[model samples]
Target: MPPANGAWAWLAPGNSWGWSNAGLISDGEESLLVDTLYDLELTDEMLAKMRDAEPLANNIDTLVNTHANGDHCHGNELVCGAEIIASSASAAEMAELPPEAMAAIVAMAPDMGEMGRYFLDCFGQFKFEGITFTPPTKTFEGELHLQVGDKPVELIEVGPAHTRGDILVHSPKDRVVYTGDILFIEGTPIIWEGPVNNWTEACRRIEAMDVDHIVPGHGPITDKHGVAAVRQYLEFVHEQARQRYDAGMSAFDAAKDIELAEYSAWSDPERIAVNVDSLYREFRGEQAASDVFELFARMAALAGYDVATP
Candidate 1:
């Protein structure tokens, strides 16, 4: 959906995994892209469509990755000659799990039991092989302001929440915000890195913004109402998980026991496992990151699938 005044949001249909949304902000011959697709083929397809819709897309001057997530930035190699920019934390985190590692994990899935099946179910659609992992060429910590022709764009860092570094690409002039994974809309948000409070605070910041169009990292384009729903979910989960933590319940047990109510209807409800675990770690003041495979195994268990210990 193209918002008024040269702002366009490329939304991928369905709230399922790996189908992320991207955006293009153009004025005159200058353009800035917000994130990319999951793989080369998907990115290529998106770029083609974008070019057809807006001529400025033919030569993107800048590319801003909202976070370190593979779905948001994995197809970066396709945007040749564009100066890639991201938060310093995001850039550092990008190297932690490259395309080769992801491809290798998916390849081993057949013999790995239920967790393997679950992993494949989420990411098997994308081709991760042969992708040259592209890191950001320009990195910043606090905030960076740029001009896309005459439109003023602001990159606001709000992270250590979704990931080590997450950002919102806000076009103040056009009243549109490209929220990385911070706003999941119809999909349940998975907190891979969080204090819960930080994520909630990020939501509040978005709600307080004057923006009219909210372009989420996943799901359809939305508005402040969508922002409120996401914030409500975060607060609900945080309170629920805190109670379970105080009761000495294991994160996995708490994830299965808690009632999601309305949020259960959201796509990928199994993500609550990771969210609860992250909250528990926060409560304990633990700074160490959990093992990704172990977390997936826990999520698989919560989803009623047999999980083999990794």
Candidate 2:
């Protein structure tokens, strides 16, 4: 559904894995797409919806990827004709893991033990094959201003939090902000890049905006209240992770030991493992990258997989 100003949010179901949201700003003749979905089929479905809602969307004039995550940008190939824009950091990160990686992971899922089964459960619905990595044609550093027909849109880079190049797409005319992964609604947000503080600050920035509708990269459409929810979760996890860090606990141990309490009900609660790992690295002033397989194993353990006995 579109807000009063022709800004539409394509929301996927909550509590489901790889279910992300996309946004569209139409001016009756041209449409600007905020982000694409995880797979070709999903993207096609979204585009079809947009076309039905606003014929202008049939000719997407511009596309902005809020971040580098495949769930947000994997369908770029489907919109290859549009002029793609992203932060330079995100453009760089986009090439680091292409669709081929997703294909390989799916191909090996059958033999990955419990982790494999869990991986399939999360992503098995998406088709990873035949996706071509299409990097952004243009990149910016801090801010960019453009127009979707007559509606002015501002792009603000707020990353090294959700991902290296996370951004917020704000349309002042529409009073909507498309927060790519920077706000994950009711879901437990995964921190691939964080000092935790940065993520929290990003939420505050969104709160500072004069917007009525917020389209999150994942989950339902929301407002500042949604931003606050994500901020609270980040702060809660940061404090918990810090307590464990002070006790010299391993990231995995801290993740396992921390009590989720109010956040336990969020979707993908095992993402606490990734959040804790990122927080531990921040606490130690170490590099933020970790082996993906090891992180998944840790998450699997926290989610009830016992690798030692399996």
Reference-based TM-score of each model: 0.98, 0.97
What is the C-alpha local distance difference test score of candidate 2?
0.87
Q: What's the residue-level lDDT of 15 in candidate 1?
A: 69
Which residue pairs of candidate 2 clash? none
Clashes of 1: 0
Off by over 4 Å in 1: 308-310
Off by over 4 Å in 2: 308-310
Put down candidate 2 lDDT per residue, 71-168, tens digits, no spaces: 88999888858999999999999999999899999999999888898788888889999998888999999999988878889999988898898999
lDDT values, one for every candidate: 0.92, 0.87
